[model samples]
Target: MIWTEINGKRGSIEIVSAIYIWIMKLPEAITHVTIYSDTCSGQNRNQYIAAFLLHLVHTHKTIKVIEQKYLESGNSFMEVDSMHSAIEKEKRFTEAYSIIDWKRIMQRARSNRHNKNVTPYNVTEFLYQDMIDVKALALMIIKNKTIAEDGETVHWFENKMSMI
Candidate 1:
């Protein structure tokens, strides 16, 4: 996908989540997957999500986890950081000022010359929804595995969950 500016607070997260979800939806026969992400917290979250999916695949004897990296090459790293900076500038402007005004400016700018098809929207949200779907699928896979192995209904009850 072509790089586009993201001005929202959770834009990076959304993009990562979307990609992870999309990858997880592929047929079970597909064995390997690679993800390219930037060195950022959002990217980290995506990696974690991808790892969980990989674990699910392994648990079902469907696929093997291969190499995954945030930076594939030096040029990719540069490109990713540059794109991130552009988005950061847009985010700063939006947060320090008015979002509506910033959105208008972004729309006008995109329409001007270098880019016309790109606009700042809730890309993160789209990705997030995809991640949610993937998570649900993974949960189902796990539940089925549990039932098959133990022949008993298993439920996940959370008493305490923390990121740290």
Candidate 2:
């Protein structure tokens, strides 16, 4: 997803919102979502995304559960990663004039003979500026907050961590 610098950095909200939107795009038959995420706390493992996922599972009728799994470092050799490696290798010595050019480079990378079993990855963008509703999201989190007996303690997101 391409957005100007003014919008926001690749932070928790952006990552969470993107995943939330992607979950919404899943077919109705898909009730459970098991997300395999990299161990980047700010982008993937933070409370914001955790809260959003919890909220989504609780509220979304079609989606009943979400399991966030983290892959070990340098272990999960994703096909998309191979495609990206090709792009990086090519762009390391080359230059991309624009976003459109970058997309072309990515498409070319997918078809590169060196990158095997790499399917065409289209650049499907979710315009964060228009898609994210900060107020609604904040409200969702607040609504889902589980109050402890002490009352001062309010909990959201994960209380327990599961590998699978």
Candidate 3:
């Protein structure tokens, strides 16, 4: 588990940056990564994140396939929600006077739950890129499908640096 300052808009860039760091930290033996995310356009389901998914496959030779799955809009139960609930519960019982304090509380909560691996990150540490070119290429390659063709449901798939 990785904890970072909850500042800035939770947009595609932030989401992709977290994903990049997470994937880089994964063991090299793991090739296929499947991510489950709520279908939020401002965050995960967008051209920019899709471009980074392409970038991941391009940069990480160990990663062959990246699948981004979305649950129906009304479906409530999700792993991310569970993580949030855990953190919120911990926060209620712990006094966080500073960011470090909050970090400590989060780490303790994870440790208490047998989640030993935790990394603390600052917003500045997230690697950012101007994805204009990649987005253009992806758009050119994917001419048939519209971003909203499926309405509220989307199954985003990336392989061999190609987004489809």
Candidate 4:
């Protein structure tokens, strides 16, 4: 799972706490996992606290925390930082303030619930796709009448077909 935070200045405690809770709730079989966060100095303390909590949990002989590091060059982190910089620039137009305002806006947006006008149907047409049923995809090889290939294995699903 990938998680990103653009407004790294605010809500550090809450975000880290939520992630810690989720990790603690996972099954004992998940012994190794990697956690990636941005290189924001403000989040360092919260991250330390979260790591301490995780250490406490591991002491009880559950899952072990494997790796925790900052995401430096990943696509998601790049996009998030780009947008964050853009928002910071825009906030400058409102007033000659530091990047803090932009950070606050991003935090508020992340924590807020989606508006009714922003329904999934309004954004995507995935509901109209004609796809294989669950039982068909579960088969090692699909044998659909529409497919002319002879005994071809289904490695990838097209956009029109949902993965089961």
lDDT winner: 2
Q: Give the TM-score of candidate 1.
A: 0.37
Q: How far off is residue 114 in model 4, in Å?
A: 13
Tens digits of per-residue lDDT for model 2, 1-164: 54444565677777776776677789999987888776666677655666677677778989887888766667776565766787787676558886667776766665636457767556555454644554466576755445643675543233334221
* Alpha carbon lDDT at 11, candidate 2: 76
Worst 10 residues of 2 by lDDT: 155-164
RMSD of 2: 4.3
| Candidate number achieving the greatest TM-score relative to the actual structure | 2
- C-alpha root-mean-square deviation, each candidate: 10.5, 4.3, 6.5, 19.2
lDDT of the candidates, in the order given: 0.45, 0.64, 0.62, 0.41
Per-residue lDDT of model 3, residues 15-34, tens digit only: 76577668888998999898
| Model 1 misplaced regions, further than 4 Å | 1-16, 24-32, 38-50, 55-66, 70-78, 89-112, 116-164
Q: In lDDT terms, how accurate is model 3?
A: 0.62
Report lDDT (Cα) of residue 150, candidate 3.
62
Q: Candidate 3 or 4, higher lDDT?
A: 3
- Flag regions of model 2 displaced more than 4 Å: 74-80, 92-94, 112-119, 131-164
Q: List the candidate numbers ranked by lDDT, top first.
A: 2, 3, 1, 4
lDDT of 1 by residue, 100-128 (tens): 55545444333435465665433222322
Better of 1 and 2 by TM-score: 2
Predicted structure 3: clash tally: 0
Those runs of model 4 whose alpha carbons end farther than 4 Å from true positions after fitting are 1-11, 44-47, 50-54, 73-164
C-alpha positional error of residue 136 in candidate 4 after TM-score superposition, expressed in Å: 54
**lDDT of candidate 3 at residue 72, scale 0 to 100:** 68
| Higher-lDDT candidate of 1 and 2 | 2
